[model samples]
Target: MTTPLTSTQQAILAYALEHTDGRIEWFPASLKGGARKKVLYSLCRHALIQPSGDNWQITPAGYEAMGRPCPAQKSVPAKPHTRQNSKQAQVIAMLSMPEGTTIPQICIATGWQAHSVRGMLSGVFKKKLGLTIVSVKTDAGDRSYRIA
Candidate 1:
């Protein structure tokens, strides 16, 4: 089934389609960062956009939505999802330790504050990432986390 883009998504698609042959750069003055990501996510989910390393590009659907002609080589610039800046990856690695690390351990390993670590754990697990956390009894405290 095909999904329709939201107005914001449509705008993002339009902007991207308009510059298929060139780089599309936007800043807060043009499109706020948070709004930009929301639109990007929507476009990506419908296959209307794809990341090319660090930039975004319009997919065929995105072009059609914009009533624009598609390029012979259809492609979109997308930001790569890397584990280097991924909280989930960091948490998963810390949870793998034999000692059964604590939240503090995760925070230290990821260079995130205790609250940030806790917030990410709550938001991502069993939700966005479809992972679950398992709590293990430890001398330090109840080290809660997901193990693969």
Candidate 2:
């Protein structure tokens, strides 16, 4: 037996499931602050939603609760190398290196300030493209980043 979801949780889950094929991106603007947090926390606790990078994606259990068929699973291919000449593309290329890339290296390559580089990493890559970025500190005390 399973517990029933509250009306708020149902609404949040429904809204999230409605976006795209299975992933949820646009959280309703109407859900603000504590109310939103409570709903999201409840869903996560019930395994109805899981974090995918910076976004929330529905789980198989979530589909079951919603009475919808889960989307068929597909193997995700490796992220392809970005060959464009744009600065953001170049930054991504640098991060894709086996040794990963440092903030200083990315800044030097893209002629961007450190803040701009950080913004791109968090905003464009994580939020927009849903890329998982891993950051590590080396013995040399320099931080490196790569797509994980």
Candidate 3:
């Protein structure tokens, strides 16, 4: 189920739909700094908008939430599965190892920053793929993860 948007979020999405044609580039005067970041973040976390190079573009779900029609675009069939040798696959391989893997190790392997790697683990691996990932903290204080 789609979570109801706060007033700030509603304003942001509605503006994107009506004015910017689904590009989120405006905010209220009071929405600034960390508060602005938080609004953008909640919108993204809810799958209402997504990164589009330099901009945040509203998604189909965002339109639905706003009770608006999605603009027509060229239809491109989406890939059904990740390619075997893609970075995502590589990370999955690392996680599948019996010994598990560490975030730092995954970051080193994929050239992704720690937060990006962590986001991938939760958003892609767990939520989307429905994988049960288990984490353990070694006595030495390092955290490791594995597919359980």
Please tell me which predicted candidate would have the highest TM-score against the true structure: 3
lDDT tens digits, residues 67-145, model 3?
8877899799986878999999999999999889999999999999999999999999999999999999977799999
Compared with the true structure, the alpha-carbon lDDT of candidate 1 equals 0.66
Q: Model 3 compared with the native: what TM-score?
A: 0.49
Pitting candidate 1 against candidate 2, the one with the higher TM-score is: 2
For residue 69, give model 3's deviation from the true position in Å: 1.9
Tell me the tens digit of each residue's lDDT in model 2 across 4-91. 9887767666777675665665556787889877777887898988889887788999989888889888989988676688887888
Better of 2 and 3 by lDDT: 3
Residues 13-50, candidate 1: write the lDDT tens digits.
55555554523444235667677777667667777777
Best by lDDT: 3
User: In model 3, what lDDT does residue 78 have?
Assistant: 80
Stretches of model 2 off by over 4 angstroms after superposition: 77-148
Q: Report clash pairs, candidate 1.
A: 51-77, 51-78, 52-77, 52-78, 55-77, 57-77, 134-145
Candidate 3 Cα deviation (angstroms), residue 74: 4.1
